[model samples]
Target chain A: MRWFNFVLLLFVTLVLQLGVGRLFGVGPQRVMPDLLLLLAVVLAFRGPADQALIACWILGLVKDLSSQAPLGSYAFAFGLLAWAIVRLREMFYGEHPITLIVLTFLCSFLAEIFVLFICSLKKVMEVESYTSFSLVIMFSAMLTAGLAPYGQWLILKLHRQLGLPRRRIYGR
Target chain B: MAGRRSERLSHKQIFTYLMMGAVVCMLLPVRVTNHLDHVLSVLVAPFSKGSQDMSLMVTDKIHQDDSGEVPSDTPEEPVDATIQDTNRLVNIEQELKYYKDLTDRLSGLRQNQSLDRARLIVAYITGSDSSNQREVKFLDRGTRNQVESGQIVIGWPKQIYKDNILNDEETDAIYEQALSGAVVGRISDAGSWTSSLQLISDPGMAMKVAIEPAPQRREDWRVKGILKGKGLGQISVHLIPATVPVKTGDVVLARSDDEGLPMDMIIGYISSCRRTEKNPVEWQILVQPAVDLQNLREVVVIKR
Candidate 1:
C-alpha cells in the first residue's frame, strides 16, 4: 500500500472527525459517525492482510492519541475488528455495498462496545446509565453504517492511488 | 492443505501478539500517555484549529441567516462599523464596571488578595473530544499561556435585550445588571499549545456551587450545594434542604476554592427543581448554563 497516501488520508479524516464532525452531531447526545472506523473497515476489506492489520492498528492509535480514552483502546478495537474482517473476508463478497454497510455498522458498534468495556474496566467515566450509553453507541453505529456505502465508494475510487488490490468480489 | 492450515495459525498467533501489544500500550503510565497526547495534539493543532474556525464561521452564518440578521459576508458600511465599535466600547466599559464591583466586594470582605493575581487568558476553541462518552473541548491556549489543568474556563453571559421602551440608558442599565461570569468548563489537560477542557456537562464533573438570589430578589441568603454534571447537557445540585426556598431561575454560583476563578462566578440557573421521589428531604435541582457551552467559539481561561 501507499503508506504516505494512507497517512495523509488518516490525518485528514482525524482532523475532520474531531473538528467539523461535531457540527453533524444529532440529538442531545450529539452522536456522531465514526469516520476513522469506517476507513479502517474499508481498507481492511481491500488491502493485503498483514499491511491492513498494521494500518488498522495505526488508525486506532491515532484515535487513542486524540481522545480522552486510554491509550490503545481504539487500537485494540480496530485491530481486533480488522483481524476478524480479514478472517471472514473469504466467506462473503467483501466488496458488495451491503457487505460494506453491515460490516461498518457491526464494527462501529463493537468498537464502541469494546472501548466502553475498557472504560468500565478502568472505571474512567461516570456514565449516567448503561441504557443511554448503549443508545448512543447504537445511533452512532447506525449513522456510520448509513454513510459507509458512500465513503467506501469514494475510497475505492482512489484504490489505485492508495495502492490497494483491485476489487474482486465477482472474480479476477 | 497442512501448509495452508499452518499459515492461518501463524497469522492468528501474530494477531494475538498484536492485541497483546495493544494491551501493553493501554497499560502504559498515564503520564507517558498524556505526554504523547500533548505531543500529537501540538503537531496537529494547525489542522484542527483551521477546521474548527471554518466550522464555527459556517455555523455563525447559518445562525445569522436563521435569525434574519444580515449576513456577515456582506461588506460592512461605515455605520455598521461604527455600531460595532460602539458595542465593543460598551462591552469593555461593562467589564470594567463588573470588575470594579468585584473589587469592592472583595475589599469589603478583606479577601482581595486572590483577585490581585487573577488573569483571564482568552482562548479559541480548536476541537473537541470525539468520543461519545466524553464531553470535552480543545482550546488553542495551553501551558505556554499559563493554562494549567483545573483552570476555570468561562464565557460571556448571553446578552439580554429588551424589546420596548428601551433607550441607550436603559440598555446600559440592563447590561450592567446582567450577571457577567458564567463558568463553562475546566482545563483537564494542558499541552504546549493546546489543552482539553472538561465541560461542565460531562458526567465526571462536579463542583461546589451555591443557590443565590437573583437580581430581583432582595433577600441575602446562600444555600451551598454540590453541583454534579448529569451528561447530555444537564447538571444537578445536591445537598440542599427541601425547606430552602429554592425555585426555578435562581442563579447557581461556583463556590470553588480554586484561586484561578473569583468567588461567586455564575455557573447556571436552576431549570427544574423537584423533591427526589426516594428522598423527601432534599431538592433535585437541574441547572441550565447561562451561556451555550456547546457552541462557544471562544472562552477565557482564568489563571492565578
Candidate 2:
C-alpha cells in the first residue's frame, strides 16, 4: 500500500471521528460511529495481508494519540482485530457489504474488549455503573455497524490510489 | 520453496512483535506516553481545529436560517428623570459594594496562594474525546499560549449583566440564569499546542468546593466541602454538615484549597441537598453545572 495514501486516509478519518463525531452522536452518552474501525476493517479485508495489519495498528495508535486512552490501547485492539479479520476473510464473500458490516460490528466489540482490558490494567476505566458502560459499548458497536456500508464504500473507492488490490484475494 | 516458507512465517512474526510493542507502550510511564501523544497530536491539530470551526459555522447557519435572525441585546427603556437620578445613586452604591466583595474574594484567593492577579486566556474548543470513562475536551491553546495544567476554566456567564447595579429583579435574573463566571472544568493535560480539559462531571475529578447563600441572604453562611464527580452529568458535594442550611438554589463555588486554581469561581447550583441516609452527619448535595458543558464553543482559562 502507498504510505501517502495511508497517511491521508488516517488524517481524514481522524478528523471526522473526533471533530464532528459529537454532532452525529445519539443519546446522552453521545455515541457516534467509529470511523477508523470501519476503515481498519476495509483495509484489512482488501489490502495485502501484512501491510493491512500494520496499517490498522497505526490507525489505532492514531486514535490513542487523539484520545485520553493509554498509548497502545487502540493499537493493540485494532491490530488484533485486523489479524482476526485477515485470518477469517476466506470464510465469507469479501465484496458483500453485509459481510463487512457484521465483521465491523463484531470486530468493534473485539477492539473494545482489548481497550477495556488495557484501561482496566492502567486503572482508568473507573466505571461507576456497569449497566451504563455496557450500553455505551453496545450502542457504539451498533452505530459503527449501521454506518459500515457507506464508510466501506467510500474507502474502497480509493483502493487504486492506495495501491491496494482492486479485488479481494479470498472467497473468489 | 524456502522463500515461500519464510514469507508464510513472516506475517505471524511481525504481528507478534507489533503486539509486543503495543504492550510495552501500554506499560510505559505516563510522562513518556503523554509526550509521544503530544507530538503526534500536533500533526493533526490544524485539521481537527479547522473541522471544528466549519462544524460550528454550519451549525450557526442552520440555526440562523431557522430563526430568521440572530438575537441581540436591546436597549433599556427610558424612565422618569427624577426616579432615574435616585436609581443612579443607588446603583453607584450597589456597584461600590460589588467591587468591594470582588476585592475581598481576590484577597482571599491570594491568601490561599491559588491566584496572584487573575489573567484570563481565551481558548477555543477544537475537539472532544468519545471515551465513556472520561469527559475530556481539547483546546486550541496549550503551553505555547501559557495554559498550564490545573488552571481553572470558565464558560461565558449565562447572563452578562448590562448594568453595574442589579436591582432585586436583575439580581434574581442573574442567579437564576447562573453565576457571574461559570466554572466548567480544569486543564488536566497540556501539550505544546493543545490541552485536555477534564470537565467537572468526570467521575475521576474531585476538587475542594464550598456552598454559599445567595447574594440577598444577609446570613453569612459559608460551608466548605469536597466536590466529587458522580458522572452522567452530575457532581456531588460531600462532607458538608447536614446541619448547614443548604437549599436547592444555593451557589456552589470552587474552594481555594486546591493549589494554583482560582478561588470562588462559580461551579454550579445545588440541585438537591439531602441528609445522607447512611451518615446523617453529612449532606449529599447534587450540583447542576452552571454551563452546558457538552456545547461549549469557547472558554476562558484563568491563569496566575
Tell me the whole-model lDDT of each prediction, alpha carbons only. 0.75, 0.72
Predicted candidate 1 versus true structure: per-residue lDDT over B183-271, tens digit per residue: 78789889888898988888778888878765456566789999888766678889999999888877787764645565456777789
- For candidate 2, what is the interface RMSD? 2.0
RMSD of each: 7.2, 7.3
Per-residue accuracy of model 2 over A48-127 as CA lDDT, tens digit each? 88888989998888888877789888998899888888888888886777898888889887787667667667766355
User: Model 1: how many Å of interface RMSD?
Assistant: 2.0
Q: Indicate the DockQ of the complex predicted as candidate 2.
A: 0.51
Writing each residue's lDDT as its tens digit, candidate 1 over A97-165 gives 898899899999999988988877776667767787888889999999999988888787988888887
Find the candidate with the highest lDDT and give its number: 1
Kindly list the per-residue Cα lDDT of model 2 for residues B1-304, writing each as its tens digit.
5555543557657778888998899999766787665666566667777887688667757755346765443222232232223223323333354456667887455343323245567676777774545678888788998999888887643223222323323434333222234678889889988888889987668888878775546467788898887555668898899889988877787754345454466677788988857899988889877666776666777777
Residues forming the 10-long window of minimal summed lDDT in candidate 2 chain B: B74-83
Number of the top-ranking candidate, with DockQ as the measure: 1
